[model samples]
Target: VSDSGLGFSHNRFIALIVSIAFLVVLFEGASELGGGMIKAQVEQTTSKFHPEKNAEDRLKPAMVLATEANIDNSVEETSEAVAAEWSAEGSCQQVIEGNDMLQFNLKEMVVSANCKEVTVTLKHTGAMPANVMGHNWVLTNNTDFMPVAQAGGAAGIENNYVPVGDQRVLAATTIIGGGQETSVTFSIDSLVVGDDYTFFCSFPGHYAIMKGAFKVI
Candidate 1:
C-alpha cells in the first residue's frame, strides 16, 4: 500500500527545510569569501598611496605606519615570517653590531616568545668617535619610525640623538663610539606579535641605512 498522504507531506517539508538551510550556508560562505577578497584589495591599494609618509597629509589620527621615499621601510605583512631572523630561544638578550659604514649586522631581530623582558645591546664596531660615527639602538613601531628618527636628529648629540621622554620610543640605547656597548632593557608585554616594528640608530642620518625589522615571535 502507498504511504499515507500526511507522511509524504511531512517528508517533503523536512526536505524543503534541509534544502533551504543548505542554500543559506552556501550563500554565507560565498559572502565571507568575497568580503575577504575585497578587504585584501583595499589594503593593498591603500599601501601604495603611503598616506602615513607625511604628517600633514593625514586625514585621520591613527597609528602612523608607512614608508617614505628613499627609505627601505617596506615590511612584510603579519602572516609572512622574516626570511632571516636572529633569535636565541632561551635568552632574552640580543646584540646588534653597527659599523662606520652605516649598516647593521642583522637585517632582522627576533624576540623569542618566552621573553617577558628583552635586552638589546648595540655595539659600535668602528674606530670613529661618538660625535662622528656614533650609533644607538632606537625602537619604534614601523610608521612612527621616520618621524621619531627625525626628532631624534633634532634632539642632538647631548641627548644621544633620541627624543627625551618621547612616548613613541619603545626603547632606546645610549649613543656609543667604537668598542663601546650600550643596551636597553624593555618589557615586551605591550608589543604585539607579528606586528611591524623598526630598530635603528637615531644618530643624524644613520637611521636611513641602519634600520632593520624588529620581530616578536
Candidate 2:
C-alpha cells in the first residue's frame, strides 16, 4: 500500500509540469499573433495620413501645378504680343481747318503711327462767336463718335461743349469761334492701326455735318 501511494504522487507531479508547459506555449503564440495584428493596424493608419504613399495621389498635385503654370504663361505672352503690336510706330504731324459754314476743310485726315507727337491746329475762319457757331476738334473710335457727340452737347458751351472726364474722347481741342484758333497735341502711341477712328466738331449741332474719318497709317 505505501509503494502504490508514492507512485501515484510522482505521476501527478509529472502531469502538472506538462500541463504548465503547454499553457506557456499557447500564451506565447497568442502574444505573437496580437503583436502582428497591431503592427498591421499601425501601418494602415499611417498610410491614410500620407497621400504620397499612393502613386496616383503623389502625381495628381504635380500635374495640377504644371497645368496652372502653363495657363498663366500663355496669358502673359498673349498680353505682351498685343501691347507690342499696338505701339509699333516711330513719329509724325498734321493740321486741320474749320470755317463758319460748319465744315472742316478735309473730309479725311491721315496720321502716321510712327509719329512720336502729333499737333493738330484748328483755324476757325468763321465770323460767329463760340456760342453761335462753336467748333471743337474731337477724336474717338467711329462707333463712339455719335454717342460722345451727343453727350458733349449736353455738357454745354461753358465746358467747351466737350464731356468732362470722358475717356471715350481720345483727343480734343477747346471750342473756338470765327477768326480764332485752337490746337491739341497727342502721342502717336495712343493710336491703333486698322481701328476706325473719327474726328468731329462736338459743338451741339455741328457734329452732324462737321465730322470726317481719321486714319492711322
Candidate 3:
C-alpha cells in the first residue's frame, strides 16, 4: 500500500533558507567590491598630473630658499630639535631691534625644523647708526654661540659682524642700522629637531646680552 505524503522536511526547509541567505551575502560583497574598484579607477583617471610637479621644479640647487616653502607640519612643530641636527636644519626668522643701548627686543627665539626654509628679519628701531649700534641676528647651538660671537667681533663692520664660513654659525642676517631692516632665509634640513638652539647677535660683546633660547615646537 503506497502512502501519499505532503509533508515538508524541516531540515530541507532550513537548508534552503540558509542557501538563499548565503547567496545574498555573497552577491552583496561582490557588488561592494566592484563599486570600490570603479571609484578607484575613476579617481586615478581624473588625477593624471603628477602630484609633485612643483616640488620637483623647486628642487634645483639655486632654489634661493624661500620663507614660504613646503616644510611639513611635523618639522615645524619640532624646530628646537633641529638645532643640534647640523644635518637637517630648519629655517628661522627673528626681528632684533638695536639702539645705542645695545639691546634686542627679544631675549630668546623659537625655531621650527618643520619649515623647509626659515627667515629672520632684523630691524633697527633706534636712532643709532650701524657703525655705532648695528645689530644682526645669528643662530647656533648653545655651546658654539659664545665662541662664534667672540670671533665675530674681530670680523669687523665690513663682514656685517659675521665671521666668514664659520661652521658653527647656523644662520645670520645682515647688520642693520637704526630705522633699517634685513632678513635671512635658509633651509631646515641642515639641522635636527628636539635639540638645544641659541639665537644671538654676534656684535663683539653682544652675545651675552643679545641671546635667547631657540625652540622647535
Q: Which candidate number maximizes lDDT?
A: 1
Residue 98 of model 3 has an lDDT of 59
lDDT of 1 by residue, 108-166 (tens): 78887679899988888898999999999999999999999999999999999999999
Score every model by TM-score: 0.60, 0.57, 0.55
Which stretches in model 2 have alpha-carbon errors above 4 Å?
1-91
What lDDT would each prediction earn against the true structure?
0.83, 0.82, 0.73
lDDT of 1 at 193: 88
* Residue ranges of candidate 3 with Cα displaced over 4 Å: 1-94
Candidate 1 ranges with C-alpha deviation above 4 Å: 1-88
User: How far in Å is the alpha carbon of 37 misplaced in model 1?
Assistant: 65
Tell me the tens digit of each residue's lDDT in model 2 across 1-217: 2334655666677788899999999999998999989999999888856756786877889999997897567546754653354432422445677888777776666667767777788999989998898899999999999999999999998888889999999899999999998899987577798788999999988899899888787
Query: Per-residue lDDT of 1-217 in model 3, one digit per residue for the tens?
Result: 2323535466766778899999999999999999999998987876555576455565654464542353333235444443444342333444445566676655546565667777788888888787877889888888998888888889997998888999899989888778998888877676777778888888777778777777665
